[model samples]
Target: MKLYIKYMVSLRCKMLVKEELTKLGLGYASLNLGMVETMGEITHEKRVQLKNNLLKSGLELLDDKKSILIEKIKNVVVEMIHHTDEIPKINYSGYLSEKLGYDYTYLSNTFSEVKGITIQHYIIKHKIERVKELLLYDELNLTEIAYKLHYSSSAHLSNQFKKVTGLTPSYFKKLKEKRTQNLENL
Candidate 1:
């Protein structure tokens, strides 16, 4: 039996959930962003207990099918973009379809309906966020960040970053530097 959860997005959240489940003596086979596969069927009382426990942590146990599916989609994208060390080389539609075991068209339509944005645009947004993080880290140069994120070139990365953030990558870095300097002086 799988329990779908809402707002269980981060690793910290997942760990907290796992702790709750263990406390209740619920054995789970797997736990992903929005879904938990239990090792065995849960009794009604146990389910209710789990629900309440999740609620206490600001996570909701999902019952609605559409909401569950939407959460799965978001988690998959988030994991792929933010969690993975290497950006996938496969086409995203193909990757999502394969990972979710649904047709690309269905996933796309469902995601668009629920999120009010195309999957491609969502992906671009995440890529920009990752670029910002990398720029802030100050470890990798623009070209390397572009290549690591699998952008065709730095120019393309810069263009998309500017489009999403309304600031050039260099300017963003400079702003961070200025803030740090001000903090140090204080």
Candidate 2:
């Protein structure tokens, strides 16, 4: 059985899902961002209980196939940006197509139809969020951040950052000492 979960974007979320399954005496083959896999089918009662528990912790159980597919797309992108040590050198469309086993155009169209935003826009949004995270950590300079996130140059990064955030990266870094906006808000 495979379970699709919402908001399971981070490593802590994976740990939490694993712990919850353990507490429920459920044996999972693996747990990853937005999903858990088990060897056997889940009972209706067990599914309900799992859904309720996940909901309590700000997660959602996706039963619909379309919803699951969308969540899978989100999970792949989020994991690549947030959890992985490095971004792939290949094109994102090709990478996503190979990873998801779907035509890039189909997936992008579905995502845009359901999410009301283009897949590329979503990637940019997530990358910007990652940039914000790196900036807040204060371990890397602007050029390094730009390079890590695959921006062409510091100037390009700054332009996009300002376009999306209404402020320069330097200004954003200074404001990070005060408060940061939620990723969804950006």
TM-score of each: 0.93, 0.91
Kindly list the per-residue Cα lDDT of model 1 for residues 1-186, writing each as its tens digit.
Answer: 999998898989999999999999999999988889999999999999999999998999988887888888888888888889876789888889988899999988998998899989988998888888989999999999999888899999999999899999999999999999999999
lDDT assessment of candidate 1: 0.91
TM-score for candidate 2, residues paired by index: 0.91
> Can you list the residue pairs that collide in candidate 1?
none
Best by TM-score: 1
Task: In angstroms, give how far residue 2 of model 2 lies from its true place.
Answer: 1.3
**How many residue-pair clashes does candidate 2 contain?**
0
Runs in model 1 lying further than 4 Å from the true structure = none
| Residue-level lDDT tens digits of model 2 in 31-67 | 8889899878988988898889888888898988878
Predictions: Cα RMSD each: 1.4, 4.8
CA lDDT, candidate 1, residue 87:
68
